[model samples]
Target: MYALYYTPGAASLVVHWLLLELDQPHELRAVDIAAREHKDASYLALNPNGVVPTLLVDGQPRYEAAALAMLLADRHGDGAFAPAPADPQRAEYLQWMFNLTATLQAPLRLWWYPGDLQCDDEAVRRGARARFEAACERLDAHLGAHGPYLLGERLSAADFYLTMLMRWSRNLPRPAHDRPHLGALARRMKARPSFAELYRREGLEEWA
Candidate 1:
């Protein structure tokens, strides 16, 4: 069984959702970021970065939401959530995964926590928002041309990651779901029974 340390509605949402999708038996250990429980020594030992989503994989701790999503999918998806190494779509699968993580997720972090830059917060947010929207537009166009899912018709780990990031934009000036194809993709993804379970488990009601 896996032990997942998570904070509701945070980056950990993708990992938690994947566990549900994979039908994996896992334990949820809530990390109260509001109370700084994540920064405590015990949690830090499990995840030195002091972040939500420290997943115990066979007794070893691993963090990073994107990495964890890919790891879980690769290990347990039976080629449904990810393409195998020799599959023709493997490269495309990896490209979308990295794009979602590095391009979309990175700037979103700044948008959420502009203080991390140690400068004018509004200015930082403006820059981050711009970067995020640009990436979103490209993704929206891609979905318009080639998707219901990032890997085309079939869902992959990247779709799970993208949906979680799209949820983060629920309150943005130009939310991700405002884009036609992205909105459609979000609708399809959220329709999955696993997504409803994820929202219920995480106690998230905003986008549900």
Candidate 2:
């Protein structure tokens, strides 16, 4: 069984959702970020970064939500939710996974937490928002051309990852779900039973 340390509706949602999607045996250990539990000594031991979603796999701790998602999908050996090493779609899969984490997720994080960029200047925040929207535009175009899934016809961990990020964008100036293609994608993904289960389990509402 896997142990996942998480705070509801955070980046942790993606990894937790992936585990359930795979029907993997796992337990969620809540680390209440609001109460500063994550910064405490005990939780710090599990995740020095003091963030949510610290995953313990085979009794070893790992952090970073996207990396954990990739690891779990790869480790499962089914290659249905994730491509195996030799799969032909592997290249595109890797490309978008890295792109989503690096390009799209980075700007969203910066935009959402402007303090992390060291100044609450509106200009800086606006720039961050602009960057994120541009990234979304690119993603929208890609989906319009080749999606129903990030990898053309088949869904993957990348889509789940995208779902979490898109959920975050609900409060943005031009929210991700407002884009026609992205909106359609979000609607399709939200229809999955796992999505409803995740909402109920995590107590997430509003963005739905």
lDDT of candidate 2 at residue 150, scale 0 to 100: 92
What ranges in model 2 sit over 4 Å off?
Answer: none
Over the stretch 149-198, how does candidate 1's per-residue lDDT look in tens digits?
88888989999899999999988899899999999999999999999899
Per-candidate TM-score against the hidden true structure? 0.98, 0.96
| TM-score quality measure for candidate 2 | 0.96
Worst 10 residues of 2 by lDDT: 112-121
Model 1 — TM-score against the truth?
0.98
- Show the colliding residue pairs in model 2: none
Model 2: per-residue Cα lDDT over 3-43, one tens digit each: 99999988899999998888899998988888999999998
Once fitted onto the true fold, the runs of candidate 1 whose alpha carbons sit more than 4 angstroms away are none
Best by lDDT, which number? 1
- Candidate 1 global CA lDDT score: 0.92
